[model samples]
Target chain A: MTQTFEIAVIGATGTVGETLVQILEELAFPVGTLYLLAGSNSAGASVPFRGKNVRVREVDEFDFSKAQLAFFAAGPAVTLGFAPRATAAGCAVIDLSGALPAEQAPPVVPEANAHVLEGLQKPFQVSSPSPSATNLAVVLAPLRGLVDIQRVSVTANLAVSALGREAVSELARQTAELLNVRPLEPAFFDRQMAFNLLAQVGKPDAKGHTDLEKRLIHELRAVLDTPALKVSATCVQAPVFFGDSLTVSLQLAAPVDLAAVNRALEAAPGIELVEEGDYPTAVGDAVGQDVVYAGRIRAGVDDPAELNMWLTSDNVRKGAALNAVQLAQLLIKRLV
Target chain B: MTQTFEIAVIGATGTVGETLVQILEELAFPVGTLYLLAGSNSAGASVPFRGKNVRVREVDEFDFSKAQLAFFAAGPAVTLGFAPRATAAGCAVIDLSGALPAEQAPPVVPEANAHVLEGLQKPFQVSSPSPSATNLAVVLAPLRGLVDIQRVSVTANLAVSALGREAVSELARQTAELLNVRPLEPAFFDRQMAFNLLAQVGKPDAKGHTDLEKRLIHELRAVLDTPALKVSATCVQAPVFFGDSLTVSLQLAAPVDLAAVNRALEAAPGIELVEEGDYPTAVGDAVGQDVVYAGRIRAGVDDPAELNMWLTSDNVRKGAALNAVQLAQLLIKRLV
Candidate 1:
């Protein structure tokens, strides 16, 4: 049975939010009515949905009384301010931001922990894992089912497009200008973004973990339900436009068969298995894709307990927008 | 007193070869004469050495007898055919390919194992450590002095520029064309090189290790002198034009102070300690630089036995050319 939903997409003009509208329509989500909410700057701007243009209204002026679900694609500050108001008005909030604390709000990846969202009576918030974690989880899910994950080490090459629309534009403009031989300047980023890779993302905590790195550590533990699992991550920004790639190493408690592990990944949901010879999945290849493309799975030659793999995904889509919409679908199906 | 000698730079038109010429002039390596040798296509190409233009001569036409030290920056195939002839003719061959089997050659990283190059009876072939190994060695050198390394897990984000000039150009051209831009094609690589990261280098061996990865493991073991120590690595290409970055997690046999480790890194040779907040060393910043920029050195919160760090360097410089030149300098000093 298909039920119609009057959905309000908060932060509708942003990268992930824009993607949310497109993906929701593409997947044929039962949207009886669509409300596009954005900041004052983007208010009244129209976006295409289901082959029609929907006008974006200012969030401050929008009424959520009729919204069956409010998808918060806005930043933490806006989500914090408006989420409670939307929830109190009898609208279920599915937030993509990590504004709420992890323990109180259930962080979810549809493929990993969608079941947690099934019994929510109060307003539900869905926090998509950071890009690195999202890619890691997709690759690690099948491996964990086959091996006891004792340790995980990852190095991420993130794209500027993951920083949202402005940064993406900045990278593109700067790259074009630089190629045409112009003076390069750093704008959206603290340093020059074109033709370079930056290793740090987000502010570093006192414990020495960058915000992105910390999120990956905490979120992975929460999603995998392995609080004591040891993880080490290094996040780097590359010169690509939209997709992010990660090289991951896992230390298993027991020996795992490479063939079985490979087969499991191939059969998993939202995953595309690339053969051994195919790897370093490029940003252009993953830009519009929803599935996590993975390849170069190999067992450590000298160490039988270790396995290596590479994963790539469109950060704005599967890592954020698609993931949020998938969570909402799970909610609608009562599967989460 | 500095010894001046006529030097021949084989593969003079290649990436590392260009850097070799630049660094020799920058470091004031006493060059009485410079001979630029390359393939027939590059025969008329000119490279600047010591403030003068030196036209490239075909490898077959170069007079080896006039040169005292020949820097072989060419690929393995060229070195295999030419190096023996040069060495047999009484020229000191500094081979960068590192393809000579262990039984016949000695791998050298001046900072880690320079002693092997001293007092050579025959023409000594000084090989730079593979990019992955060289990077790992730079970070590990400081730590090894403080703790016993149990094992290491590394994921290298190797830039396409590391493949040499042709690959870099091809990547740039393909990337532009893929975006609906005009043809920027440069025929230096096997595939469309733009906006893509290729994970394969040096081809894969029978046992599934890339020739580059396998060589890195073997060279690292040999340089560290821990034949039994376990090391695992995954090398991936990033879209950046220069600079290779690595995320490393090392297991120590005994706990060590993170502060003390950072201090050691600051004092280490060929290493520049990047500030904690400064990471993701961009290609522009790392390019034309000789130092291995090390940053984000931290201990894993979940595991005290492990340490994580980000290391970046210009692959053409520190990873290949500069290291080769440094090896020659060390040999002259009798420190090798």
Candidate 2:
């Protein structure tokens, strides 16, 4: 007999939160009771779960102690404040935001860093990797053991949904406006994003790197556990809606055979390898899937020791929601 | 007083050719007589030159001997057949196609390699640098003397206009359709380009590298005269209508100071340097401009020897039409 757990999903009406509810049912997670909670504006809304409408409760009024496991897909401010309260109330929390848990729980990509959760149980606060870092970690995890990775250079093409549902709606409206030759005003992004590529994703830090780029590097180092890993990232906001794409170049410590690398990527978990003659596209291949779809893999022509490839995944599904769901499943298994 | 020359513009009805005609007038080129020629299909159509409409003549029916200078902005096959015929008929040819000249004339980016055109006269044949190579050559030419560039890695984000007018129209149509929830069918590009980035540009060679990538490597070496300069290029088609963007990384033989690199880029001809805080964007800064706008220049975190930057330019203006006009001006100067 399976033991069912009471679950709470914060920000349940948002993009990732709604997906998380659907993914829970799709994955057939045994749930005794499901509670959907959102901000006051979205509190009265109804969201579907398991073919039934679940009424969203106001997060401010909900008690954290009611649920055994709580998934926080809320924004940073909400996660920073309420996550602590939820954890103190004896509920396990899986943060999808790239925030450090109050308990300083290790950031985990279950397929990449499952060893970290070997003995963890309920009442522990942990993090599911950010959609950006999760995809990169999944691809780089297998290669770390195959050969020492000296350095990595990533050019991530992020979609609008990485911002939020407002960004998606803005893109749609702005695109329509532009098509009808109406003037555009940027609201969500600081620049025009419709039918255009914006090199700046998040705001820049003191060193001139955007927050998104810096986060990718910091998280990859901790998740990969290569304390001195050299990472260079350039994040661009592509004119896409659902998927995140990356052009990654890896400098290996030793020269690895191309055929061997190909074999390893093909067999790697949480990734699907599309070799030459079939490149992986964002909308066509990655938007609905949980796997990291990768292609255009090659040994760098300038240096055989370097490997380059294109990686894409559903930033909403694999990057955030599915990654969180997968982590929750891993945590649930160790609950007993 | 400016001396005038008889000019023939092949492919007069096409996108770049139209831009070429407008730019020639905008820059006040000395044109005694302008002959507009296209395929048989566009024979009776009229194109505007100097506020006057000139009837488009069938390319086959026009006599190449009548014009003193011929600008072949036509497709490669048309250029291959007609350019040689025009050259044989005692007319000088300026090719924008970037193919090796049929008469083995040197390819030139006038701003960077104008010295190559020193004593060349009328009836001589030459090729203009492709828009890709022109901007890169202009930026790299000045730096070659200051620092020895050992290797270059470029990720070019190209616009639909790079493909042609049909592509621009398709992007416009597809974007409008997508906004209205209408179905889409790919025409010019094999993938959906409404709000997506395509990893593939040109057809792949036997080694899985696309022809566009190989051409960038070859032309950069030839134009910069860095014979052994190693280049790894990945060309991605972005979903914009008019501008081109590139993320470039350069490995130098010796470490160079950041201040010196900034000075060289700023002083370089036909390029405007944007500093760290303010970066140049493709759509915002590059369209309708002759300058290659570049910014985000920085050193690699792992190795300061590696320099990276963002480059953008008007693909039609600087990338094609203006580069050709500049070359023709150089050729005309030599003739006088």
Models 1 onward score TM values of 0.93, 0.93
Candidate 1 iRMSD, 1 decimal: 2.2
Model 1, residue B196: C-alpha shift (Å):
3.2
Tens-digit per-residue lDDT, A1-336, candidate 2: 989999999989988999999999999998889999988999999999888899999988989999989999988777887888888899998887767642376788877887877756557777877777889999888876687887777788899998889999888878888888899988877777887777677766655677677678877887888768877778888889889888887877777677777788888999999968779889888998989998888776657777778889999899989888888888888775
Off by over 4 Å in 2: A101-103, A119-123, A145-148, A253-256, A301-303, B101-105, B119-123, B145-148, B252-256, B301-303
Q: Which DockQ-derived CAPRI band holds candidate 2?
A: medium
Q: Give fnat, all candidates.
A: 0.54, 0.39
Provide the clashing-pair count of each candidate structure: 8, 1
Backbone clashes in model 1, listed as residue pairs: A117-A336, A118-A336, A198-B280, A199-B279, A199-B280, B115-B336, B171-B193, B175-B194
For model 2, how does the per-residue alpha-carbon lDDT over B1-336 read when each residue is reduced to its tens digit? Answer: 779999999989888999999999998999999999999988899988888999999999889989889999887778887988888898889887766542376667876878877746557777776677777888888787787786677778888888888899999988888777898888877778888878778777655677667667767777777767867777888888888888777877777677888899888899999977778888788899989988877776556677877788988889888888988887887656
